[model samples]
Every structure is written in C-alpha cells, then in structure tokens.
Target: MPVPPLPNAFLIRPIAHRALHDGNRTRAENGRLAVEAAIARGYGIEIDVQPSADGDAMVFHDYDLGRVTTATGAIRQRSADALANVSYRTGEVGIPTLAQICDQIAGRVPLLIEIKDQDGMMGSDIGTLGSSVAKVLRDYEGPLAVMSFNPHAVAEMRDLLPDVPRGLTTSDFPKKDWLLLSDARRAELASLDKVEAVGASFISHKITALDHPPVLALKERGIPVLCWTVKSAAQEIKARKVAQNITFEGYLPA
Candidate 1:
C-alpha cells in the first residue's frame, strides 16, 4: 500500500523540537511539561522514542539517561515501569511512555515522532524499538508521522504501520561526526539510495545540508522537505529557501 500523503498541518506549523524546550531551564526536552507547552502555544510537536528493557516505547532521547535525568545507565537497560519512576534533573516529571504522550496530545496537534536508532550504527539490526512504537501507536487517532535517521528502522515502520506516513531523517554524514559509519556507508546514506525502496513520503534533512543534491532532487520531484534544529529566525529564513517547514528550537518562529 502507498504511504499516506504528508498532511498540510505538518507543513503549516513550526514543529517544536523536543516540544519547545528551553535548555531545560523550565521544561525539559521530551518532558510532559514541554509537550504541554507546545500544545499551549499551537505548534506541532516532534519527539524521539527509545525502547525500554521490557520492549515498551518510552518518549525520551539519548541512549543513556545521564544527560537529562539523575539516573546513570543505558535507557534500554531499565524496564518501562522503572523508567516511568526515574526523575528528570530539570523537572518533576518522570519519563513518559509513547502511550502517555499520545493520550496527552489526544489529537490536539500534529505529532512527528523520530524513532531513535537502536542499531547504533544505522545498520539493519532493528525491530524491537520499531515494533514497540508500532504497538503503542496502533490505535492512536491523530495527524502523525514517523521517521528515523536509520533507513532500516524506517523500513520496519513501513511494514509495521502501513497506514501511517513515514519518512527519513537525513544528513550529509560527515566522517568526523559519524565515526561509526564507514566511508562506503556514509556515501550510500548521503546518496539517499534507499528512499524509494523504503517508501519515504518526505524527508527531514539536516538544516545545514538542505541544499545537498539528492535532497534538492527529491524536492524537485515534489517531496515535502522539512529541516531540523533551526535555532534562530535568520536560519529559518535561509532554510525556508529549500525546506517547506522546520523543526525548530531556541527562539520561537514568527
């Protein structure tokens, strides 16, 4: 079956990166408070998911818990119940499950979810995290889409949630930043060779790499292009020359 069209709602609103986070000064990234803040302000919300030890999808970023939480270990090492009890260093809320986030949003606004790569190196070693996300969103009735930096993970979502729109989170794959990927792998990813095979409906490319040939080519073919982490109004202005929408943070898009 063909992937559903990328909804205009996703293109019309400035998506709040990790839900309008402010360096964790008040609302922590992916925290319940942040999500509520985004909804209150009328922006689409984008969040990442990582699987818990028990194969439940948890709405938190980072493979490790040390950065955002007082806890100190791999997030995948803990059970969903244990993760729900873990405290965030920046706020009072515990880690949220995907189900919890879905109920929180309740279709009030469009949701864009990025499935954080469990394969570590963007390989084919996936299934658990993707399946967990699929299970949680199976009955969700809302305007939403799923994507991943890992094409294999996106492919998994393609099979698991055939009715849901899917996309690729893409980048230039610079060697210095992507040390885990080999030269061949980086070239292949940069080329976006798997986009057609995986059936991506859109692409959220790295903001700085929006002009990359393959991304522009996809845009020429009428693909809706979204860019990530645009931190300021000026960057948003420049990114809009190529991107149809943005995933932004820091200052609010006007």
Candidate 2:
C-alpha cells in the first residue's frame, strides 16, 4: 500500500477544539455536540479514543466514565455496550464507538484521535488496542492522525498503522508536573519512538513567553509544531509571531 499524503489543514486554517460544544452548555471534551459543531463550522475535529472493557474502541477522553458520562467506574471495567447507554455530561449524549464517530464525520472533516494511556488503561495487552484502532480506521478514507502522551502506545500505533501520522503530546501547560519535572526530562520523552513531530501544549500566556526561537526552530527542520488550546485572536496573533501552528478551541481566526 502507498503512503498517502497528510492533510494540509494546518497550512493556513484553525482547528475546532473537541467539536465546539460552546461554553459547556453541552458536554465538555470529546462529545457528540462538540464534534457535530466542528463539522458544521468546517474545522478539523480533535477527539480522544479509549478501549472499552469489551475490547472495542470508543470515543472518550477519560479512563473513568463518571466525569463525562453517567457511569462511575473505570472504562476498562465496563464493556462498550454498558457505556452505550451511559449519557455524557452533555445531556443525553452517550459514549460513541470508533464506527459511530467515523460514520458521523468520515468525509465531513479531518480528525485527530488521541489514544490515551494515562494509567496504561489498554490493559495488560500491548498491540491489541492499537491494532484494533488501526483495523477499524484502515478503510476510513478520511484525514486522521493518532496522538498520545505515551510514546509506547504511539509506537504500537506506528506498527499497527504505519500509514497514519503520529503526534506526541506534552505538558508545557502551567501545571504542577511541568514544574516538578525538569526540561531535560521533557526533552527525553519528546525524543522517543522515532516520532515524526510534537504538539507543544501549554496555557496561552505561557505560550507567548515560550522560547519562540527554539520552538519554531523545530518547524524549520521540517518537524511541524502544534500549540494547544489557544482560545483568543490575541493569543493567535502572538503565536503567529513565533510558531504558526497554534491550536485553538472554538475561537474564530480573525
């Protein structure tokens, strides 16, 4: 099989952050309303994928279902069918499967699927979850990329679906762990798994103050960069001054 060209979305467009649920009126994170809204607005969709206890792949952002759904147990503890009826915080939206999500926006918009491994929740299995996603999305015939904070999971994805582009997530965000871990540790993780690129996730304020010269320095070498969750035109302007690849949340590109 030939390696297809990547989607040229970031060339000059902004992405819709988790389907534009719009101010928590609906469910937050990767819910139906947010995704649908993103499709309608003509922006790329960013959603998370996690393994169901039944070994199915579902669209969800958390290992624990309580925060986003009616269920209160770990996702690995419940089967996909059990989660089917559990409504998301966005009113009546239920957990969605890979098939359901792909079916909804297969051709409408590009997708960024985050394969989370927070607690190594894919269970004791290694390639099963990653390969499962690979098979399901093999014929998807749409623009997509697999991302994760876990380089090992991303590596598994690389093996399972070598055609799919992979991205690594990091905490440049004004968070506790970033302060706890040295920049050296962060750089070490960034260099893992023969990763093609990186997404620099940080608060808007922190981004402006970031070592811009070094950040774009990566992009200069053909390694594209994506900054996380910028919700304002001002922040976008600031990012444009340094890194052109800035991620946004429902904020219009003025």
Candidate 3:
C-alpha cells in the first residue's frame, strides 16, 4: 500500500509542552498537566509510550525514572498502579496510562504515539512496550498513528494494529553516543536505510538532519516527513521549509 499521508495538521502538540506554566515550570512528558494543556489548546498530542512491569502501556519518555519522577531505576520496573501513585518533583502530577490520556483527550485532537523500545531497541513479549501500547490503542477511535525508532516495533505495530498509520523515527546515523559501533550497525539502528523494509508510512526525522540524503530521498519519493522538537520560530521556519509537519514545544507556532 502507498504510504499514508502525514497528519493533515501542520503543528503537532508535543507532550513536553503540556503544562499550565509556560517555561521552566512545565512538567515532564506524559503528565496530566501536559496532556490537558495540549487538549485545551486544541493541538494534536505527541506522546511516548513504554510498558510497565504489569503490561500496561504507560505514557512516559525516559527509560529511567530519576529524571522526571520521585522514583529511581528503570520505569519498566514499576507496575502501572505503582507508577500512577508516583509524583513528579513538583508534587502535583503523576504518570498516566495511555488509556487515561486518551480518555482525557477524548478525541479532541489528533494523537501521535511514539512506542518506546525496550533494552537492545527490540522488545521480547506481550509484556514488550510496543505490544502493550498496541493493545491499549487497539480500540481507540480517533486521529492517531504510531511511530518509533525501533523498526521492529513499527513492523510489529503494523501487524498488531494494522488500521493505525505507522512511521519510522530517524536521526543521523551513528548518533554521537554510538560512534563506537560499526557503521553498518549504526545505520541499521538509525532506520534510514530500511524504511521500506520496515513498512513505514511516513518519516519523523530529526529537524536538524532534514537535509540528510536519506530524508531528502524519502521526500522526493512523495513520502511525508514530520520533523520533531522544533522549539523556536526560526527552527519552525527552517523545519517548515523542509518538512510537511512539525512536532513542536516550548512556544506556539506563529
């Protein structure tokens, strides 16, 4: 099948911007404040999903808990019920489940769900993060799509949730931290060389890397490119010039 179109909307609502406070006070990813903020603003929500120990798809970003929550260790170590009770450093918000987020939004706007991978960038079972997310989103009726850096996860979503659009999230290969890996290994992990094999309907690329040859090649083939984490008007301007849509936060698009 032809690649599905990117969300018709131009501005995608990133979960990071979902906070009542504008700047520094914004809570971490996948919180009530952030989800509500995006919903109230009438913007499509972009969220990350990882599975809890008990197999619930939890809306969170980091693999570790220390950065955003009062807890420590891998987020996967906690059950959804335990995570729900954990508070943010600000002490008002707790992590939410994908179901809760969907209910709160109630199809008010589009949703871009990024299924985070487990260790080794590929998950192992029904308990795998991607599988759990697919299970939760199975019945969701709304404007939604699932994308991921892990092509395997994207392919699994393709099989598990065929109706939902799926895309590949790509960044520059051999990301600074992966310089030690073989060039072939880094390229494989980046997904730039395997978009068709993974069955991606679109591409969510790192904004700064939009000019990369693979990205430009994908755009040339009429594939929609959605860029991420655009924070400033200048960056948005540059991103818009290259990408069909943008996932933005920090400030509203002009």
Candidate 4:
C-alpha cells in the first residue's frame, strides 16, 4: 500500500501505539520503550496523559493503574515521583511522566496524547484535565497532537492551548446500523465535513466494524484515518483491510 503524504507531516505514515512493546521491552503499556519502538521503527507514537490529584502531569492511560502497573489506587491519588515506583512485572518500567516522555523523545516522533476526562467514569478524580494538559505540553519540542472522546475536552484544549494539533477517537467500532446516533447528531459528527471543524487533523476509529460507510467517506476526503486496538495478526489484517494504516500493540508489521 502506498503511504499517503500527510500535509505538514512530521514523521512517517504508521504510528506506534503505547510505544513498541515486544519482548526485550518493558512490561508496561505506555512507557519509554514503546515510544522508542515507534522512533526506532521510524513511525509516530501515541499515548495518553492526565493529571495526578496534586496537579502534576503524567503519562498514563487508565483512570487507575490497575492493569498496567503494580499500583492499585487511582493514579490521581499518586504523585509523579510516587508513580515512578510502580514498575512493570516482567520488566522494570517505572511509570513515566509527560515531561519525561516529551524531554526524552524530543523531535523523535509525533506524540499523540489523549487527555482523559472524568465525565462518566466512576471514581475518576482527574481534576481539570485540559489545564493539566496545557501546563505539561507547554514546553514539549517535537511533533505532537491531542485527542479525546470528549469533544468538550477537545474544545477546552483549543481554548486553553490553541496551537496544539488535536484529533477525535471513536469506536465506530460497532456496526453502523447498531449505532444509535440521532439524525442531527449523526449528521454533525458522523460525516466528514463536520469533522473538519472539530479541530481534528486526523481521527482514530476502532477496527471491529472496519470499512464502515462513514469512515470510508472520511478517507475519501484526504483526511487520514488511524485504526486502533490492533493487537494481533488477525486484527491487524482486519484494520488494514479498511484503513490506510494503524496504531497497535505488540508490533508494527509494516
């Protein structure tokens, strides 16, 4: 497949998700090794960042560190230095900070950061998601973009720090028919035109319901489509079957 040129493209077409995490890498999901893999493989890397309860910026995905780290409590409860004590099981991966990620990866790859909001999740104590993101990325030096499922957070990012690139993530992961968007809501976000005004330079959509009508329509307009959660060879095949490229765990095959 021919890799389309991304206008103002900083890096290559393919992006590494949560950094490169094959064996010999750390046991953590979002870590320096994963970002290193993306850079070593000559692609971009995507990650999630949110604030701790004390208002320091950190690089983490879950509302809590249950899955990826040895930590048991909500990450918000932990400080940046404290979170560093939590390591990967098999490999020693101290939880990294946003500043650490940016400082270490300077100009290496595009840092796609998702600012986690506490809109609906229970026990989520992420205080002021947008401002926290703004405070951290203020000094980052490299290709970077911000994205979120919450459009309001995206809007907040725009208002707080207007220069950063942003994108939207959706699971249009299910079949379109199964989706329950109303006519007006669908017309606005489900279409490509409205997506332009959403401050999204590119968008990440899940792969379960690949080649969906609306997603394809977005691609036809020159907007880059990034497929996600591609974990295995089979999932990679399915995601690649529909979109130009993808971000995945384990490895970047192409």
**Which predicted model would earn the best TM-score?**
1
lDDT of 1 at 166: 93
TM-score of 1: 0.98
Number of clashes in every candidate structure? 0, 3, 1, 3
| TM-scores for candidates 1 onward, in order | 0.98, 0.81, 0.89, 0.80
| Alpha carbon lDDT at 46, candidate 2 | 73
Q: Which model, 3 or 4, shows the larger lDDT? A: 3
lDDT of 1 at 40: 93
Q: What are the per-residue Cα lDDT tens digits for candidate 4 across 43-159?
A: 777788867767777887888777766668899888877878887654665778887888878977677787876664211243586787788788777677887765667666666
Task: Tell me the lDDT of candidate 1.
Answer: 0.92
lDDT of each: 0.92, 0.64, 0.74, 0.68
Per-residue alpha-carbon lDDT of candidate 2 for residues 40-59, written as tens digits (9 for 90 to 100): 77777777788888788888
**What is the clash count of model 2?**
3
Clashing pairs in 2: 19-34, 19-35, 27-90
- Choose the strongest candidate by lDDT: 1
How are the candidates ranked when ordered by TM-score, highest leading?
1, 3, 2, 4
**Candidate ordering by lDDT (highest first):** 1, 3, 4, 2
Model 2: lDDT equals 0.64
Off by over 4 Å in 1: none
